[model samples]
Target: MDIDGADKQEEKPVKKAKVAAAQASASAESAAPYPDMALAQDIHRLTMIHAGKLSVDDATSITGTKPEDLLERVMLRVGAGSSKPFDDVIKENEEKYKAIEKEEGKDVSKVEAKEKEEQVDDSEEPLLNPELYRHLQSTLAYNSSSALSEDQLKTLAAHNESILAILAEGVTKAKEEAGDMEVLHATMEIARYQAKTGTKESALAAYENVLALPKLSVGKKLDGHLEMARVCSFWGDWRQMKDVLEKAQKIIASGGDWDRRNRLKAYQSLSNILVREFEPASKLLLGGIATFSCTELCEYPEYIMYAIITNLLFLKRTELKKNIIDGSEVLQVAKEIPVVLKLANTLYECDYKAYLHTIVDLQPHLVANRYLQPHSGYILRELHVLAFQQFLDSYQSVTLDSMAASFGVGTEFLDMQLSRFIAAGRLTAKIDKYGGVVETNRPDWKNARYQEMIQKGDLLLNRIQKLGRVVDL
Candidate 1:
């Protein structure tokens, strides 16, 4: 059985996407870059840079106002890996900033315009959410600029400062008055602003307060949790992200709107995958495939990749064929990355050897993903286990060499791998070393209790029925 598994990560295929992602929001005039999206883009490029698909120089060009910061982080040190020392770049940027400050000193025209902008009308329109601030900021910035520069940074810094003041004033004013609309919008502004522009700790803290507000609406409360969940995910705060997501799930349980429910699925699926919880992740990704509108965390095409990865890991052939092979949403992005469909078909077609190599090809992409990097080994290992088990289910007994041939691995290597997994209870087949054969002892007892892991023309179920008859006598 040879499975030609598809490589999930290909920076070249997504190169234009990455450049667009980085460039689309690459302006000093734009509202401050949403911190999570910015971090994700950098991580995407960093993995590409490390994997040789993207050069370090290209990465620098593709990243933020501080190319040195990303390069330094990429090399694990800005100065050590490249010819240029990081400290020098840091010094240069500082000096450049000081010179800009001196130039801005006499620039009263910009300041005067900014001052008027900050003097907000203090209207707490019931529907005027603080999240709209990010939407307005992102919209304004996207329309105005491309490529961040020192001047852009200065402008953005001042922009954040001005906006933060307005949001802070709104929050304080709402606190003094304590009306439902005023409190919800005011708190959301602080939470949403911090999520987009401030640190994770501050964002999480602000969100905590939002969720604590008695006057917060159900929809607004769920929004707060989801935003915090995204912030936690971007910062690699999985533990907190899990709690926040679970809380979101609870809120949605009491009847969230369609959009909110789907966004929760997208957010939870991403979090579950990062934390190595594949089962629930698979369900969420597969269920929310059609209604995936949560691009704030990731693009739809990228979301499809996650659905493919998780479902391929756990879905049985019948389930795989129905949900993925026949899935319209998964097929829609088929041309964008054929490998995702290729990988799924390889597994479904029972091409074990091809699937193994496909995983090998995908290793770089999996390892490069910021969210998937930590569990790269675990996911691959589980895929292999699924493949090996799928292979064994077709056999009552097979020689070690034959099984090895089925998977394109050496007999010795297969034996070693099988032994470890069998011992770990990952595989149900047992290796008979002296006989040079592996025998599967498929237990209907457990399968009936959980996964009915049977394939077409397999005797596992008949054997279970016979055993049940014997017990009845």
Candidate 2:
């Protein structure tokens, strides 16, 4: 029995040893790979160097990484470090600079150091044409003011040929420093010079530079885009004009009071492009007309007028003849114009009759006045007349329901016109306790000015209304 018990105890010890060996083998197979401690230390050292806590040389020595490699990595990760880190680097560099200065201590400050640094000559050297520089500086200063003399502008233009390159460089540096207002003013002066000299390319380049500036405010950006578009149009670059107008549209669509002028200018620019392109006018007209109508409804009559005129011209030329057989199509296009005119007259609170006459007479020159160009006027006027007619024939008394139903536009749009009319004393509204209107005054057809506006509007309306007339079937 003792011998048997000893054998079992020996077998148990052998079994335990085999089980321990198997467990060890399994752990070795399943264990994760160990990280490189040396590599981890190097990375930590680089991080410290990047944080400005250690010099690049010290970091390199400690981590055993090459100085160039370490610096490349550091720059890649931290983007050349902060200004404070740069200042530290400069301080570190100063000792080496000073050692060179001491070694070349033969009054080297007086001599221009070609080896390390170039000393600036503080001595006045007649300003390298002092008269010209003074003139350029004065021109810059004058342009910065609200009103500049014609002679001053002329002088600036004359001297611009000599100093424009220098001025552009200075402006670029100023923009980089966030002093872009001065640069903008200087660029405008330069643009004027370019325009006067008929240097369309230079003018466009200057305007484009202004547009590319990142730090400009939204208003300035809009102005730049509009100006650039105008310049591109003058250059007869329709594709570029389209691009600038599309960008301007994006800016206008993003709802803001500050953008009103931009929105107006953008719509006008787009209208000109469509007039010029004379293709796909319908899609452009329908897509943006609603937004522009809303703008007009919200008291932006000029913009509304612009949109209406553009769409009217587009439809008059494109859809009027083709879709004349369809009553709904004719009515749909016709209804949009009068609502726009009614809103414009109501909002501006001017004599609608006088305004209509002025518009008709001035229509030939409206494009010229707006864009300061003569070529675009005639086409713009034709379009304006077409829109005026459509509005007259489709005139449903400017009631809330009629206005909404006629345009197939939203109630908020009609309400905008109502609000503007009420404000202008042309409309009186009866509102409930919640500021919702119960009733509103209908436009008086008997008023002399109203009748005249309608009469003048009819002259234009007659042309468009003829499109909807019964054909001899």
Candidate 3:
């Protein structure tokens, strides 16, 4: 019995040892950290460390991983030892700055402004650290689809020409490794650079590339269409310009936050399109005026002047005064931009010379604008024709030389312009070159009125016949 009990005790020890080994194995399996999870956590930690949101050691503690591999991966260099508090460092530097300012006897704001100007200059071609650049490059290669952040895109958009070249090169290299979406994004940036520095054709081609991309967002597509229209307008391709504007309007009508901005652009473009043809422009101008809010018009006062002048030229001043000019909002704005007021006074007074001079004085400013450049010649011609027609209303006949002198143009040029109007049936006159005189061809209003009445009577008779048929049924 004693021997058996001793044997059982020995077996008991062996069983306990086995159980202990199993628990230790379980514990190790539970504590074993995954390499991938560690790498991800370390990446975020490294970012925080670089952004100054976390001290290196603090990030290390939160991550519970040795950061040697992470530091190498990010290619970041940390100053040895604990970092001084950021605010304290800034405060110390500011004190030194103030001391230097005191010695120079300069205003603090002026000094700060000067420093900011210098910073702005430096920002034009900011130098990226080699280590950091390499790190970002590798990151973009690996995560091509998510290569750039919003902040990064803004920075790239704002960078100066020299820096844009560098960024463009980097993005091009990244394209090989990037996915479709990333490639699209990079393509957009490349195109913007091309547009800013290259020819309109290249920029247009770039924008077209973006449009061709699959599954693009509506806002992006809308932006692309608008840009294409602008390029077309820039080169005076009216047909192409109208097509793209139609495309953009469809997108805007579909509805989004981009509605207001897109509508504004549409109106601005439409204004440019009708610049030479004011009569048709007057129709569209009303819609544009109704579409824009008071705040928006404030940003684009030029468009406001356009709307006002269009109505005035159409003899719809009473209506415009009722809806716009007399409105509290527009009246306040008009007080600031008096161009429309001056133009109205000149037109109302029937002072053709003053009107011509007013347009001439404002022509340099208006014609210099990107949208208005193409229409400057047209505006002048239209005004000249209107002035001539008005001046001729009271005259039975006028010598070409006398008319040209009054209008500040050559007699031959005036006669040629009149010939075009006469040929087009726009002017009721004939040139008698032998006498150097223009004779008015008065129309018989009584006969024309009788023809108009007969046509209206025919239309009324048809409508009455249709009503009789309905009553009989």
Candidate 4:
């Protein structure tokens, strides 16, 4: 029965599997470039036949192949393989030929030859007239090593704007070729002189021209951007100021080693824009703080501080004459505030004492409604003292451990407080000499209060030590 069934099945159907391998192999070979260089050349030749540069008959005659096959190969190489489109490639070749003719001065017609020779002689003469030369010399001499006199700069700036730009460019080029640092120094002096004498527009134009020079490096570009941003900020052109800062940030982010001072200045300019414009200040600040926390770049602290101070000042302004506080909103703001302050204090010239004083003064009022805590007040006191001590004693630099010890708490507790300082731009953290471990400092301690506190803390610590020694004896 089984044998009979098998025979019936065989008679009923015979199956065959269809493989697509042969078709795919053919398709791949068609897509690939010719393996032989001679074949590639033949293809390229055929493509050039209709390219208008070569006659189709000549192309076929040279390659000893049909115009169609030559065209196909050329299209495959230029259009689809190793060559460009036939028309474009031919046009480029034609342009090159014309350029060679132009370089050899073969394009000069008989009538124009005599005129061209005369023109060449005219071009050899210096463009600067006697009077202009005298003025240029006097200006260069006066502004050589020092800042230009206000009157002289004003006089020069009063001339055509393009003249100032040309002069600046010339100076930049000469200095660059001469490898003289003093050139930039002199240029800045001239710019300052112009700015001070009411030729700010010309001065900026001159600086802009200098910045636009190709020889200027990334560092120089940043300097120019920073200077422009500063001028714009002074003019209350916040938008342009922001734009320049953003450009500087991009340059720096792309591995440009801008001077530290310029980086900080750029950040300050951006922060000022945020504060003044009130456009996305909070988000920018928060993002900047987060970036600093992650990257630990030099400018991160500056950004974090800028955000913290701007936000705190904003909040402080709002808090005045307000009794009802939204807990969720306040907490959300508060949480980020510490983070910003912590980063700020670690790296910037933070006004820790002022920030602490502000926090302390406001804490009592805030605590009444359970907005802050007693511990928060204590942390402020400790921060103030610790920062003060650091400011007083050169060796006693403020750090999380020192701050924590002052409050009899762990580093974690101090870290929380430090976060607020970082957010506020009063403090910053860095990898210490020990490596991998963090250290902290207050960047904005320039105020007299911080100095005063430092002195007072020194006196108080001394007295306590003396009393303890007496009691032991």
Candidate 5:
């Protein structure tokens, strides 16, 4: 009996050991995120390093990130001088392992990076370009009260050419040597410089070269693609911006962490906004508002405004009240941008005339916005259509003169506006030109379903008739 009891005790310890081992293996397998979560969220886009032609004060007001702090972040990416290669900070990172499966016979995380040389004090292609840095430093002196003189612009154009020539030579050498790290470093130096001081077309070409680099990890490639989207966005090229964002999405699918996935969502939302895809844009923007760290894309306050505006367009009354009117996030920033708040409240309160007038005043803001300027025409059109629909919703038919007076617009002017929207099928209403009345026709799901069923029935009857003829033959 004593021997049997001792054996059972030994078996219990063995079982415990096995269970502990299983738990440890599971933890290691699920080591999804390697770096600190905070570190992952702090993505480095060109916005952090360059403010384009804006002086320090102007850039600060526009982006809400101080130029000096942006410069400091730039120093982190590169160093104070030629002490670092453009990509040494990332390339020299310790060996990283992700438990991601190989796809298409390529392990994205397995790309080999060359070790950093002990002495990189004078790399042929240093991360910092003194010429560009001087320009950025000088911008701070003027406080952005005036634009640059033509002579200064000409000097800068020449300066950028000289720097590009030097960077290109280094890139050529790295290509000849077949060093992956050197190639990446050299290429990024050119890309970063172009993004900072050159034209949008030049910056885009440089980023395309960066993405074309061989054997870069998916993460690195995504960074390049996202930056390209930003460049395209700043220049108001939605077509290219849309393409870049699509490419970034595919890279994320192969392998990505939580932070990068969310970053892509933010970029996509902006694209959707520009394209007038308000539904998806509203969802993403509103959900991401609280935790939005993509300050490189826009300021936090700007993000909140987009969320409110988009939701206002897409959401029903209950949802608008729940999410925007009463939501703490929207309320907190609403007062700061009184114009946007007034726009939202007027619409919610059914003050149609006031809403249209406020939006008229708001048109200049939209037109001047770097991101929304291109779509300002379509946006204004949509806002007018929405107001018309809401105003006509309560009546089966209303005289054109009465409708125009209600909106505080002239009868002839309102007639033209309603006629345009009606023709475009944007408004669920019709204008009776002879009767001088507007008649509402809100969509009915049952009517649509009935029409679909009749179409299907006709198709089935034709098919049966053909089968009967074949049988007769």
Candidate 6:
């Protein structure tokens, strides 16, 4: 009896260890990327089992399945194999639904009579809940497809709208049935589609709705705030962007994980950019660039060039050198994103023409990046001023035509640009439009020196008079 008890005690520890391991594994998997193949397979298998879409034996035999394999099996079972598309599936379901409608129309009274007769059959249950079945099938169809084309996008958008309508028909019931996370995820997905398809207003509304949901998780709220910030960025709404970012940062500070670090850093970088806080932006970008994983770096490579550009703009070369350029990672990243090196070199050499050409070449890419897009106009203006200042340093007086030719622009354009600078009190020079020359009118150092001495004498005289009065002299 003692031997058996000892064996049971040992088994208890083993069981506890297994339970702990399983829990740890589950937590790790939950934090993994959505597209992780292994995690997808696990979710697929569990979903199939829970929905009774697979038999017990089949479920037992479904170990070590790949995502593609699961997708193929589900497609084949639904009469949608490699040759079939999502549109065909939708059309097929629509046809079946139409046929059911016709049958119900002809047999309405008969169905009512049959239902009355079978009222005593209390144990009877629906073979399939139509709503759940439809939801499942639509999800499967969506997951089984490859990248969506424009036509697919239109179809999907309509489908999502209908789903939203259905959910809206009973908001309380939908929340109870789908849970807050699922609803929030659906809303975010729809908002993203709207944003991508040029329905910015609708997207913004949907994102705001996500924030309004009660009992929403911090993670989902943060995501909604971040997405709204992106929308604000698209419109160059810096104040709204700042507000959304502040909310997102608060959520993260409350206990968001490292998995969200890259996104947080990216948003902070952008917020700094919009406010023209280049020094903090540069530091944030460099810190993220240094600490982010290879996968993260690949996912958010825009940080590299933005960092280099910000440092160059602020002339924080010493800090940039100490924190970034002097490091080996900058060189490695430069190899991955060559624009970093190009911008750095252009800034160092003060090559206005080359810099302008580089900026023009990279305009499309800059406009696409969420962090950089909102600030592109400001960045371009700063570049133009820097380029003009560099060109001005080379000559005391240059003809507008010569300057235009050097900058590869027309005289009128150059005149307009220089005029803007002059008006802004930035250039410290004037344009001699009649003479067709731009002349440097920097303050004369000797006269400025004499004026500084006179001011100092006046200040000293005032101080002496005050002191003499205090001393009763």
Window of ten residues with lowest summed lDDT in model 1:
1-10
Best by TM-score: 1
Error of 3 at 459 (Å): 6.8
lDDT of each: 0.62, 0.39, 0.49, 0.39, 0.59, 0.54
> What TM-score, computed on C-alpha atoms, does each candidate reach?
0.65, 0.29, 0.46, 0.27, 0.58, 0.47
Which regions of candidate 4 fall more than 4 Å away from where they truly are? 1-177, 180-186, 258-309, 313-473
Per-residue alpha-carbon lDDT of model 3 for 401-473, expressed as tens digits?
8877766678898899899888887778889999999887767799999999999999999999999999999
lDDT of 2 at 2: 12
Write one digit per residue (lDDT tens) for candidate 5, span 169-211: 6677667764676677667756866765555678789988988
Write model 4 residue lDDT over 1-473, tens digit each, in one string.
Answer: 11001111100011112122111122122111111223222322322333343455554444455565543333232221223443353345345323322322222233134333433322112121222223323422322222224453344334324333543553555465543343543354345333322223554685676566555667666656655654543333445656777777777676664233334343453544333443355445433332222111112323333444344433432341131032222233343235434423331344443444455443322222111121234434443544534433343344556545544567775556556655665545542433323454535567778898999999999999999999999
RMSD to the hidden true structure, all candidates: 12.8, 31.4, 28.2, 31.1, 17.3, 19.8
Better of 3 and 6 by lDDT: 6
C-alpha-based local distance difference test score of model 4 = 0.39
Task: Name the TM-score of candidate 5.
Answer: 0.58
Better of 3 and 5 by TM-score: 5
Give the runs in model 3 whose Cα sits over 4 Å from its true position: 1-187, 231-240, 250-277, 290-299, 308-317, 320-340, 351-353, 387-450, 456-473
Best by lDDT: 1
Tens-digit lDDT track of model 1 for 236-255: 66777889889888888887
- Cα lDDT tens digits, model 2, 1-473, are 11001111100111111111112122122111111111212333333343454455544443356644543332222111223343343344344334433333233223223422322211110111222223323422322222324453354344444455544554565456534565555455445334323344666776676677666766666656655654554433555666877787687576435334424443454445334543344344444433332221112223334444444445543443333223232234433235434433321332334444445433322321222122245543453333333433333333445434544556686466545545555444432325443354445657978889889999988877776674532
Q: For residues 131-154, could you state the per-residue lDDT of candidate 6 as single tens digits?
A: 222333465444544433446445
